[model samples]
Target: MTHATTTDGVRIAYQLQGQGAPLVLLAGQANNHHWWDQVRADFHPARSTLTLDYRGTGDSDKPDAPYSTELFAEDVIAVLDRLGIDRADVYGTSMGGRVAQQLAARHPHRVAALVLGCTSPGGPHGVERSNDVRKALAQPRPEAARQALLELMYTPRWLDSHPGPHHTLGDPGMPAHARRHHLAASNRHDAWELLPDIAAPTLVIHGADDLLNPAANAPLLADRIPGARLELIPQARHAYFEEFRALAGPLVLDFLTTAPSRP
Candidate 1:
């Protein structure tokens, strides 16, 4: 376990794995480094992986103040600085995707390539979960939120084939506090206008069956950004990267490895 101090003086926790060019995995809402566990091994022998738990999630210190995606992007930069990595390919899912885009816009020099998974550029109603999710999370019932999330996160076939009691999304398990923090941070995020300025080569991947954010958002992202490739994984959903790591892993690795270098 390693640590870095963010610009706001928050102690962020992260773990480094593999050995090669650095690749950072920024997890989605209410999730942390553990969310990348299933796919981390696939990047081996090619890219060193840096997975972080943003402040208030995983092993990172939780401050009471409200947080935003911009702050999270800065936290990611600070993590890279602590590891002495000047540039890295970034992979962000959901909330992480927001930070990834913001990072690319604000700190283009630090980012090499970008992989956005199951995410959207937040504007007014960007990727709002169903009202059920809002009520469930607001009720602060961890189990209900988890179950409701699973519905939108995975396709019906994947959920049916999988056994009972799905894997928890968060590292320490999803608690009410984490869910609340996620909702607040998500609401505070807005990165739609900045999409045009992202100079890094980008790959936008989404599950065709994704109910939470819908696969349509992928094309919307690719269409707005210059030279962004959009790939819709068939029969997959939001957490398909975790459920079908075999498929998602190679897709991302290839995207990073084969993308043309930036000028």
Candidate 2:
């Protein structure tokens, strides 16, 4: 457990685990470093993993102001800088993936490789969520919202077979206002025009059944980024890493460990 101060004086909480080359894990909207708990072991031992709580979530400061993808990217940079890590592999899920896009585009030298999971580039090319899903996400009660989220995030089979032990709501969880701010930040994220600027070896992974971001966005992201590869997990939903860790884990580790081809 450690904290890094962003340029704006916001204290960002992050954790460094295991040993080997640094591999930063960025969580989606409303999620903190603990979101990666389910799959943390996948990268450890072979690679040191850095997990962080984005401002407005977890132990990080919540300023109650408008948030942007670029701002989140800078917070990530602050964590890396404080740790004295000059370069590292990055894996971002959902909104975290959006921030990874900006980081790779705006600060190419800092990223050695990139993995984008269950996320979108935003703009016209990206698929919007259904009204029902949005409404469910906006529920005032955390339990109700979590129920709504489960339907959109996992397949029925996975949920039926493995139930309970679910993550708790509140405190470490995102508050209503913070969730709104994160959503607003996500809504404004548009990296379609900047994809071509990414020079790192990139991998775009998505669940075929993801409703929030949709699977169609994966191909678009792969196409826009030069030499990017796309991988889809069948019958999986938004939280494939959690529901299908056995498969998603190896794929991510292999991509992050593989050497990039010289031009």
Among these predictions, the greatest TM-score belongs to 2
Look at candidate 2 and tell me the lDDT of residue 101: 98
lDDT of each: 0.82, 0.88
lDDT of 1 by residue, 90-121 (tens): 99998888889899999999989999988888
Candidate 2 lDDT over 203-252, as tens digits, reads 99999999977898999999999999999999999988888899999998
Can you give the lDDT of residue 250 in candidate 2? 91
TM-score of 1: 0.90
**RMSD value for candidate 1:** 2.3
Every model: Cα RMSD to truth: 2.3, 2.0
